[model samples]
Target: MRRSELVLLASFTLGLLTTRDAFAWCRTTTTQGFVPTSEKPCDDTGIPLYWSTRCVGFSVQRDASRWIDLATTRSVAQKSFDAWKNSSCPADPVSCTGSFDQGHPSIEVKDLGPVSCDCVEYNGKVGNANTIVFRDLAWTECDGTPKSDADTTLALTTVTFNTETGEIYDADMEVNTANNPITTDDPPGRVLYDFQSILTHEAGHFLGLAHTNLPQPTDKTKTPTMYARYEQREVYMRDLSNDDVCAICAAYPPNRSAPCDTTPRRGLALECGGGDPETTTKSGCGCMVLGQKPSGLDAVIVGATCLLGLGVVARRRRR
Candidate 1:
């Protein structure tokens, strides 16, 4: 019926610490979760929130951007996924200088081909995979971005999950081609939003990674990809920072194992076909009815009759 709130406010609201200093990465919390535990620890505060499975699925919209061809778009998307997939600890803390030689494995990010529509859905009658879509026009889908009514968001990642088990079912990304000039190649003097940079950032959210509130030191070149905001042509966002890799590895480890179906939310037919896929999963593993978009995943209150908990972390919030 409605979409859930994925905007994270903590990243901006809190004053950031230096990279040498340890800080917290914001996670989505539901009424049932966000509790306290050493294993599934919250921040200094107690809140248990993390993706319980690996092998997340995502799809790209068929209508390619005018600035880039369909093949180029998909290629860039795959490269973004690989950036995180290849991330490890040494890159962090300056090549794991402060940490040991423990290695983190990569999570599987499946690429399901083109589709007709680029809107978010949450009805049980149909099923869809996590999606990456391009909006060449104004963003009108979910009443605009989480921060305001105006269209200022460059891109977003909306994740749906089961509050009861902290299991994510669907995660989708939408890039704002209407507001920002997105491009694959760099032009002299003209600043353009790099597709790979933003895709890597959004993919972190899709894989259950959260934004870290830590600020980059004056001499630093790049912070975490999960940092709340990024500057145009900031290719540093294309890769995982130490914090980005650390939080992700902690949440969904490389060697971590689970029962996951990496299959696209829609089958191959929907991938090659030029239309939206079926919305319902007979086994009900894809999505369920939420009725309305949630306000904030971390602050959601679970009522007596509330359905299973689903966590969402939107990438557009300034805070």
Candidate 2:
């Protein structure tokens, strides 16, 4: 199937958008079975996916992008994560009336430098890297197969989580510099996609947020950072709106007592294939050789992209 068709199908299968408020901020969900009868805040489909930890580490692909340098790419990435990381949830009382103040989201993003693996992958039994790669060559599948929306997709994010529990294991982002002209310019010139805005939106997906509104939103002021589409030279998504803040805060409420460790789960795997030698030793497990997947895993990969026509890249079933 085409990328767009696959995405539409995934949306329908996963139920595209789920929100508690009418403003349209939604968290990405995966289905295992049915919701429980008791009201422990269960999603109707299955479970809402989220990072179970307070600190998350992300790495930029070592082969950054042909269009932009590695230093700039890394810099833009930190700024993008900061757009959501630094947001003040529940709207400060000073800015708006009748609003209560809540602390920032209970999450901290750390830059784990660059890695050799540009592919969107998650290792169940071995080491893995939460990566942000730029496809300056072509927008193809992880195995190099051509994608139907190669020319249209701006970026994509792949999130791996336990299907049974909705706890995210790893997330990787791929930017379509192959087809899109990404700019670091403040206004992003005509038809040039803003790099910061694109990464910020992808970061939302990396953090387990689905699009705020499916069919285009009419309220410009309420247009969230998680909106599924991007317009030419549009940089508005670089900042989080009220809806975006609410969604993130709801997913990760401020908890000062939460442990803050900025390490990628299972340590860090820098290469595309096989685990990091150090990581493997630390975890006391063998590295994946020749791209072989470990057996008996219950994890599923759910990807949410930045622009329209991007699909959920892969969903690995149990072996």
The best candidate in terms of TM-score: 2
State in Å the error of residue 230, model 1.
Answer: 1.2
lDDT for residue 72 in candidate 2, whole number 0-100: 91
TM-score of each: 0.67, 0.73
Tens digits of lDDT, candidate 1, 240-266: 766776666666555666756676433
> Each prediction's Cα lDDT score?
0.55, 0.66
RMSD of 1: 12.5
Best by lDDT: 2
lDDT accuracy of residue 23 in candidate 1: 43
In candidate 1, residue 248 scores what lDDT? 64
Error of 1 at 163 (Å): 1.4
Give the backbone clash total of model 2: 0
Local lDDT at 161 for model 1: 58
**Model 2: how far is 96 from its true place, Å?**
13
lDDT of 2 by residue, 1-319 (tens): 6999999898775442323333356666754322222232334465778887888898998878878889998999999888777877664221222243677888867898899887766665667888888888788755686655665578877666655567787888888888877888885344367788888888888888776643445865355777667766567778887777777877787754567776776678888654222221111111111121222443233322222223222333438
